[model samples]
Target: MELQRLRDVFRTALDLPADAPVDDLHYQDHEKWDSLAHMSLIAALEDEFDVMIDTEDVINMSSFGEATRILGKYGVDFNG
Candidate 1:
């Protein structure tokens, strides 16, 4: 459930197809993932999950898969 919501965040931010594979989506893979999009993504995620991510985690969240892990640190349980 949470992962799907996370996917929705990615989908909306990147303008990606709903069926787009998340795991393979990375920093260099999409042209839309520029600095502006990165900040938008961070804002969307923070608003969605109600968590404040610091700079390091924001920098480290370079991919969709990594997003799951970083969000885990904030107690957003995708597995549940």
Candidate 2:
């Protein structure tokens, strides 16, 4: 459920297809994910998860896998 929610956030922020593979997407992996879109994606994730991400982590949030790991630090239970 949380993963799906993150995918939704990606779709909204990155302008991807509703059925696009968001979990494996990385920053620059898709043409739509420029720096502007990266910040937009970050904002969407922050808003959706209600978690404040540090600037360093924002830089490190380059992939969905890494993102889930980072979000885990904020108490987002990916297992749920």
Candidate 3:
């Protein structure tokens, strides 16, 4: 469920396939994930998890895997 939800955020951010691989995700890697899209992503993720992420985490969220790792620190167990 978490994975799917995370994917939904990515899909919305990048306008990419819903099932895009984690490794394929990157800032500016897609047309939709530019500066504005990055802010949108932070909002989307905060909304999805109901948790506030620090500015450091937002800056570090450059890829799907990185996002999963950062959220883990916020008590979000994506593996569960």
Q: lDDT: which candidate is best?
A: 2
Return the TM-score for each candidate structure: 0.92, 0.96, 0.86
Ranking by lDDT: 2, 1, 3
Best-performing candidate as measured by TM-score: 2
In candidate 2, residue 57 scores what lDDT? 95
Clashing residue pairs in candidate 3 are none
TM-score between candidate 2 and the true structure = 0.96
Q: Per-residue error at 8 for model 1, in Å?
A: 0.3
Deviating ranges (above 4 Å) for candidate 3: 17-23
Candidate 1 C-alpha lDDT tens digits along 1-80: 99899999998888788887776788867888888899899999999999999999999999999999999999999888
lDDT of every model, 2 decimals: 0.90, 0.92, 0.84
Model 2 steric clash pairs? none
Scanning candidate 3 in windows of ten residues, the lowest lDDT window is 14-23
What's the ranking of the predictions by TM-score, best on top?
A: 2, 1, 3
> Which residues of candidate 2, in runs, are more than 4 Å off?
none
- Whose TM-score is higher: candidate 1's or candidate 3's? 1
Query: lDDT score, residue 69, model 2?
Result: 95
**RMSD of each candidate?**
1.0, 0.7, 1.6
